[model samples]
Target: MLREFLQSHLPQYLYVIGRPHLARMNYNELKIHILGLFEPTQEFDSLKIRELLSTDWTLKLTDKAVEMALLRYWRQGLLSRTRRAGRFQYALTERGFARKEWLLNNG
Candidate 1:
């Protein structure tokens, strides 16, 4: 089931690269990749987002790095968050959604 899910959701190009190490990304690139993960109305916690970044995008980032980025976005009003079960659940704001679409389209 995991394999099937990966096959369905992961892009063909990521498989071709054999899991590239994307840790050296620039700020804008990192923002693009991270923001691209969310749907307009979807919410995800930090750990789940980190897992998706590692498994789907082949990014090897520390938990703190992801958390810091999320916090930054929250501060910038690109993300909204609420405390849930002792953790924060983050969702993209309208600005974030627009930015994600712009980045995807322009890149």
Candidate 2:
């Protein structure tokens, strides 16, 4: 059971070890990471994004920081936001998708 757990979870830790700066990412780095989290058809609110960043990326960012980034992306046309269930859920737009690809290649 321990082995299974390690096998399942080792990669996340390994990733963090490989990229120590994730723990202290600046805004542009944070934006790139947040952009990578999106799927073309999926939407995520700030809280959900924050949780994923914590667990998957090993990033410990405040709720306000994540929300502000999301809002900034929305305003920049990189993401689209909609109010649902009293929260703003954000998804990637076409421009954002293109930007993600470009960043992955050049950034």
Candidate 3:
């Protein structure tokens, strides 16, 4: 009896919960964009990256998205990740430099 009563009380409407989605750029495009940020040698946290690229895209960009992209590049040997200022900071790797060179020449 209790189970039947609870089922009837469940709102007769269906609600779909989801996060706001953006037209995510391809990883290679981000790779090129991020490569430009590296200097002789530089490290950046998620906040710094988001701030740098915020004006480039039309849709809203979040820090978490930047972090995930950074991590993906880092995993692909494009960026080196390390702990700095109590958080993970990233720098371009040698492979990243080579990729950057290719972009500069071919792009």
Which model scores highest in lDDT? 1
Candidate 3's TM-score: 0.66
lDDT of 2 by residue, 10-104 (tens): 33433344353455554455666788778799898878888777764345677888788888899999999899999888999999999877765
User: Which candidate gets the maximum TM-score versus the true structure?
Assistant: 1
Pick out the ten consecutive residues of candidate 1 with the lowest summed lDDT.
Answer: 1-10
The true-versus-predicted C-alpha distance at residue 40 of model 1, in Å, is 1.4
Provide the clash count, candidate 1: 0
Per-model TM-score, in order, reads 0.76, 0.75, 0.66
- Best-to-worst lDDT order: 1, 2, 3
- Model 3 stretches with alpha carbons more than 4 Å out: 1-27, 57-59
State the lDDT of candidate 1 residue by residue for 1-107, as single tens digits. Answer: 32344344445543234655653655565576678777888999888888777764456778888899999999988899999999899999999998777765554
- Report how far residue 36 has shifted in candidate 3, in Å: 1.4
lDDT of 3 by residue, 1-107 (tens): 22232223323221111424345544454566667677648888867777777744332566776778788888989899888878888888899889877765555
